[model samples]
Target: MAEGLFGVHAAALEVRSQRMGVLASNIANASTPNFKARDIDFTTALNAVESQPGGVGADLGGAVKYRVPTNPSMDGNTVELSTEQTAFAENAVQYQSTLAFLNGRIGQITRALKGE
Candidate 1:
């Protein structure tokens, strides 16, 4: 029952949260020399987790990858501040949505258990 409740959204939420962290790191290092921006392939990571029998938790370290910069910097830094900010914002929204879904699922489960 709990496993079904957290099936896909749990994995998606973890991926989104990991992506947000990566985007934040990229934004934070935008001014640093030769700092390469990194991100996760959300679909791939989510798929991997969802394919597993156990519902995915917060473990998302291996899904990280380097971002290909549209405009390469002279200092070899790939951290584009605007792009990173946009990605971060999008990921944050997705994370919130997933969280809401999880909360709703929990609420439904609670209500059902109470026979309400």
Candidate 2:
């Protein structure tokens, strides 16, 4: 069940991954004058996701705290392109790695089924 996988290493990794995407988006728009840099509090989001009874990893990000514009931009653009890109790339790689692991696990299960 996806629920069982929720607390598993793979699931946790996936959750972090999605969070990374959000962070990247925030960073990318950091210089957009008015773009609000968005970041998810991972621990809190995960807990909220877990609290849902149906399953795990099913609930999307619970609540996003738009980083307060400590420095208001005159142009209204808040994207920090370079920073966001770097974060996005890193998150993408991690997400891919986790996906590969999960795929391998599924393959092993398939082999076992065939053997049986």
Candidate 3:
């Protein structure tokens, strides 16, 4: 029932949340030598989640992958600060959007339950 009410937003929120963590990690490791930046394939992760029953307990391991840098650094770190920041900002926005959608849906459900 909850899944039906929330639809893809629930799973998307989870994916976005995870993605934020990955992006943040990349940003955090920007100066670390030999640190290979990683990211989640959002579409793949979302699909995997939606395919699961109730969109729960979906494994994101397959979706996480190393990000290839546009320019290889001498230090062997794949994390480009600008790229990581951009991705992080984008992911943050997406995460907030998904959260808003879920909140709105929940509010609607609550109102309906209360005969409002």
Candidate 4:
């Protein structure tokens, strides 16, 4: 019952959290030479998680792919400051949203258990 309650949102939260780390890494490496920006494909990851049992951490990052920069850099660095920052901010928001949803679900479950 607990497992059913959590469902895909739980998996989404985990993936979003992991994605935050990846995005942060991209932002941090923006100026580093030859550093390539990378991100996780959330849809693919979510699908993978839903398809298999005990799939929370099962190849969670197998869908990680490199970002294609809009502007080419001479230093061979793929991390663009603007792009990385934007992606980071977006990912952060999504992470927060997912956390909020999970929190709400937990609250509902708690209330139910308490007969509220």
Clashes of each: 0, 22, 0, 0
Quick one: best lDDT, which candidate? 3
Ranking by TM-score: 3, 4, 1, 2
Candidate 1, residues 1-116, lDDT tens digits: the string is 55566777877886787687778888889989999999998877887677666644645556778999999999999998888988888888889998999999999989999999
Candidate 2 residues 1-116, lDDT tens each? 66564335455564676678688668656655556776666677666666666434555655566655444567876545665576577767877777777777778778898995
What lDDT would each prediction earn against the true structure?
Answer: 0.82, 0.64, 0.89, 0.82
For 1-116, candidate 3 gives per-residue lDDT tens digits of 76778887899987888888889999999999999999999999999888888666678899999999999799999998999999999988888888988989889989999999
Q: What is the alpha-carbon lDDT of model 2 when measured against the actual structure?
A: 0.64
Q: For model 4, which pairs clash?
A: none
Evaluation by lDDT, superior candidate among 1 and 2: 1
Candidate 1: segments with Cα more than 4 A from true spot: 52-62
TM agreement with the true structure for every prediction:
0.87, 0.65, 0.92, 0.89
Error of 2 at 81 (Å): 1.4
lDDT per residue, candidate 4, 17-114, as tens digits? 77888889988887899998999999987887777776667576677999998997999999888877887788888888878888998899899999
TM-score of 3: 0.92
